[model samples]
Target: MNRSIDIFDTTLRDGTQGEKVAFSAEDKLRIARQLDAFGINYIEGGWPGSNPRDMEFFELAADASFEHARIVAFGSTCRAGASPEEDRNLRLLVEAGTSVVCIFGKSWLLHVEKALQITAGQNLEIIRDSVGFLKQHGKEVIYDAEHFFDGYKSDPEYALSTLKAAEEAGADTVVLCDTNGGTLPHEISEIVAEVHKRVDIPVGIHAHNDCELGVANAMAAVRSGCTHVQGTVNGYGERCGNTNLCSLIPNLQLKQDYECIPDEKLEELTALSRFVSELANLNPDIRQPYVGRSAFAHKGGIHVSAVMKNEDTYEHVPPSRVGNSRRVLVSDLSGRSNISYKAEQLGIKLDKYGDNVSEIVQKLKELENKGYQFEAAEASFELLVKRMTGVWEEFFKLEGFRIIVEKNVSGSSRTEATLRIKVNDQAEHCAAEGNGPVHALDKALRKALHKFYPEISNMHLNDYKVRVLNEKDGTGADVRVLIDSAEHGKSWGTVGVSHNIIDASWQALTDSFGYYLAQKQKSIQQKEVI
Candidate 1:
């Protein structure tokens, strides 16, 4: 029987050490549950006794049954000359109610001499006592040799003694940490091979990404016979980050033929990644491997054409394997095939060989030459497609609109907007005040549209981004605004462009509401069918 590799996820612990990342106790529990659902072998919650939120998380986690992963508590080893049973940190790890306890010990001689103010022998004793105490308590102990690579390079004998201490004390796993993340692949491979020769126990690799070589170094360690790999989802951690399990897991399973995560749970990878980012209130990294938005997106004409011909030409692995899909983007560099493919994706049938299609293509090129990026403005592109295909019917029309802003000397600025909209044959007038002219105008417009479509009340704008089109200093530099909105469980994005910021905002807002109504109509039609 083949032995399985362990996937130890440190997202809740090390990942929160990343800059601008903080999770509440609730957020940590939610992410922990999702990681458990993702079939990770080990889930490191955090340093339980160090923070209230982490302590709460461990208490909450103990009550729930993990489907696959074992919860682990993390902390430093017992202090020098102290019994592990009396060490506060070690006791906290045990009280966290986890099956496994991971403790870090100073492996670098410099850290022992300067940081801990202790000799190398005392550091070894700390490791031995900590691991032995934890094991005596019937808990699986993982000893993380902190700064193991740099320690080995600085004093090989001292670092080897640290591992020997843990090995002799019954540590279930001895993880070599590239703490500073400065080691290269060759150095890691050589050190891991040497450690494997010296230790009789299974070795694990915990790498950081200071040199952006964490994944490469971890993979090299596996090739050198390490059985456990530790990383955070999306490479989240302090400074640069730890290794990314998103890339590591797939590589181990598909390339190395190692069982890191269960095969049946592979499809949950992307969802798990996004879910964690959401809980952390961080935007998903678009370029992350196997689980990012741009992982399978094809933009260049040559690439899209080739991908449409044979997906393997551009993609090393199938997108579906990781719960992602291939996307063919339309842009100035796009060929007719890219546009036609995008149209098909939007459920718009266009005659690729007809005059109308050629006209739309030429118009698209002309607009792109004027600095309209269709890829980022997909909602506008969809509206254009509907118009060209004669599938869109205007339900209402805009007559005129004016916005006024007044700044008070002793108070805040006030914005009042007025709108005159024509609904069918009748005209309706509406007025509203907002914090800004755009807000006032949006409120007034939505207020008017409420007479016709009350469902617009459910729509709310989520994000807005603006980009200047040209590099010009003076007038005539067009600006673009991208708007993201959601109604119910469905979300849609729209874009607008103009020299005037308010006009661009209005265009985007109109398209957003239009898309919402379109989705509503589709849902109604589906319900009628059922």
Candidate 2:
């Protein structure tokens, strides 16, 4: 077996079928270039006949040069009664102008009988005709056997016959698809092994994630005899999802000793996953394997200690291998080791605070027991460490603050906030209006501090979330507010907890400002010392 496998990315086509997933023709081009740069073998642009947007992408991609990947247009085979020349779908595939074309044909008897309303022989004829037609146009054809797994289980002979039809018709590759995504890994391995025996051409696998086994099934197929694997980045597709190339690539290259892409390009996997998710306008799954924010994050004290000593103790592979970093998170479960690890990560010297590290752990535990979570609020945790070390200085002293919310007769609302603060014995007072109370407070505080510390103006709150600690307390429940503030391209998270939501927001808001100012001062001092 040639250990080298062909990777086909369907993110632009199948991925867009996912709910809330939308991409423009330009976005598809951008993604196609990225995939090419990563050395993917095939890029399925979209079903050109299905939409004008897909055709637009294909037309735009015509002029683009890719070093590795061949852009492929996807569509279905000719209609049962229609000849390949008269088929609009096949015509669009040719018009797509790509060197390679992929077309799916009915394999399941259920779809042939009910969906297509065609006889079994007719389905086979269309499959053969469609592949032959694309081949006649000087295009390499990849025939997708839709619902192959279920179809094989239902009628093994007929399913094998369909593969034979496409293969005999000069299809470059025949892909078996788990269209409904319900097949087991063992079944995939068995079926793929059988198909490889019956077909001389290379076998491929395209598995969906309905049963959360898409990646597993793809692995099985490869173990059997598959050389081409089809998937989407981050598993973005209809219903559950498609096989996640993000997960599969690493598993194949690092674990299974398969060559999916260039060895050096393996490290770019995490970055590519995040890039696609960003372009797709979807939040990256923090828990996703290999590419997620939390993939290598350690929170338990023992785990952190072991990982710090020997990362391989707790991690399956070095996170850096995938363009990801290992993170030591501080929470109530953290011990002195966790604090030491985190301080080292932040470049904070803890040698002077030797015994004080224990106190820091105690304080962290106490705070977390009171509805304070440091997992997402590393900025707040850093400040806590600075304060415990007696190296933090008070940036400002709050005197008083008040907020007023008024509703008008036309269902309109207005909010205003006023605040007083002392900056090095200089009393500053200011007032500002905003759409919400938190926004008003943020505006007013910046207004008061802009003169003493104009750098505060550079930072703004980008995200805010409030979680009620106890719903049993209802209106009086304690709330934990997390605020994400960004300065230029950099960002940090701060957190605060209190009985009143407004107070909680105020605490997080203040911490966010305080963290930025402190970091700015440290940076300036470092430059001065140098």
Candidate 3:
């Protein structure tokens, strides 16, 4: 029989513990539904007895519908010396109304004595009662052996005794947690294999990323025959965060043949990863593995050429399998093949062997050598391709513009800017004031085009980043400005460079606007055709 692994997502409970990773009750509900839609096996909603946010989240989740995942309430074992029925913590776990309850208890002898202030035997009793009480209440019980690997390393006999206690008490699955996240992969495999040898129950792994081996450790546990994987989407958690399920699930399904999700639903992994980060109001890490912006982005000239011939030459798997696509970056090292490939991606056709393709590649290299980078500014590259393909459209023409800065004696400053432009043979002059020169210039330019392209108002610059190209050049250092613009729900990036900061900002700003206009035009034309 083919092996199957259960994917347990803890983004709601453990992921919220990450620094600056707070989620409202509504945010938790939203994420829970997304996880469910992705066919996760289990969703640990939150600790019911911990806080109002978590308590209310469970109350809401109890009523909400989850198709593929069973909602699970997370908590610890009853307090020392407390009866299982009367312990407020355990009571809340039952009252949380989840069909499943996961409770973690002390495993290490040191933690039993120091953290719980209970005798070793009493700790075992706590484990036994906690799992048994939940099982008796007709709830599927999951027992997490907190600090299991470290405990196993410190006292193998005592750790095995804890697992034995939970298993004997009817715990459904025994989860070994690398609470400190300090165990190496081989150590985890060796220890887990030993526990599986002695215990007769399903095994699970929950790891943290303190040692940066969270995913590696989870995979190691699976390699050791553990059937359950617990992790947070995007690896959000306290300290260094927990295991990244985004990277682990694909590895299991594709390489290890573990079947974590249905083959069709596997592609939703990337969106699910980003959805969690978006709800947390955190900037998604573009370089994250598997589901990141740069995961399949090729910037090297040689790599892009090979990828064009055979995707397997540079990528491990088809990006479509994970809802991501291969990205070719245009830069100083780009060849004619890179230009042709990029043009094809942007819906432009070019001869595979053409003199114009070589000329465009040469021009892009010449510009990049003069401090222009198109890798992060795909909008500008598209515009460049259109120009090279002889299909470039001038949305508007810019006339000379100037800005004036005035400061008062009280140390307050004001910036004013004027812009002149022509749209469809009609000249438009506009002036605006702002808190800074760049802001003033941006407003002035937008005002000049708002009449010609009113939708430009909806396309606001979401982020602006500046990078100095030559700091050692001092006053003559060239600066590059990258602007990320958003209209409706779509976003595009554009770049510009110059010795003057304003000029660089304006160049990027202009490209951002032109990119938006070009996209709008294409969208309208497509609608008309359809």
- Top-scoring candidate (lDDT): 2
User: For model 1, how does the per-residue alpha-carbon lDDT over 159-236 read when each residue is reduced to its tens digit?
Assistant: 999999999999999999999999999999999999988999999999999999989999999999999999999899
Model 1's number of clashes is 0
- TM-score for each of the candidates: 0.96, 0.97, 0.97
Model 3 ranges off by over 4 Å = none
List runs of model 1 lying over 4 Å from the truth: 1-3, 474-476
Q: List the residue pairs that clash in candidate 2.
A: none
Pairs that collide in candidate 1 are none
lDDT of 2 by residue, 1-530 (tens): 14899999999999999999999999999999999999899999999999889989998999899999999999999998999999999998999999999999988999999999989999999999999999999999999999999999999999999999999999999999999999999999999989988999999999999999999999999999999999999999999999999999999999988999998998999989988998998999999999999999999999998987898899999999999988889999999889999888777889887788999999999999999999999999998998889888989999999999999899999999999999999999899999999999999999999998999978989899999999999989999999999998788999999999899998899899999998899899999999
Could you arrange the candidates by lDDT from highest to lowest?
A: 2, 3, 1
325-429, model 3: which lDDT tens digit per residue? 788888887887688889988888787436778788889988898788898889999998888778888898888789999999999998999988888988989
Count of clashing residue pairs in every prediction: 0, 0, 0
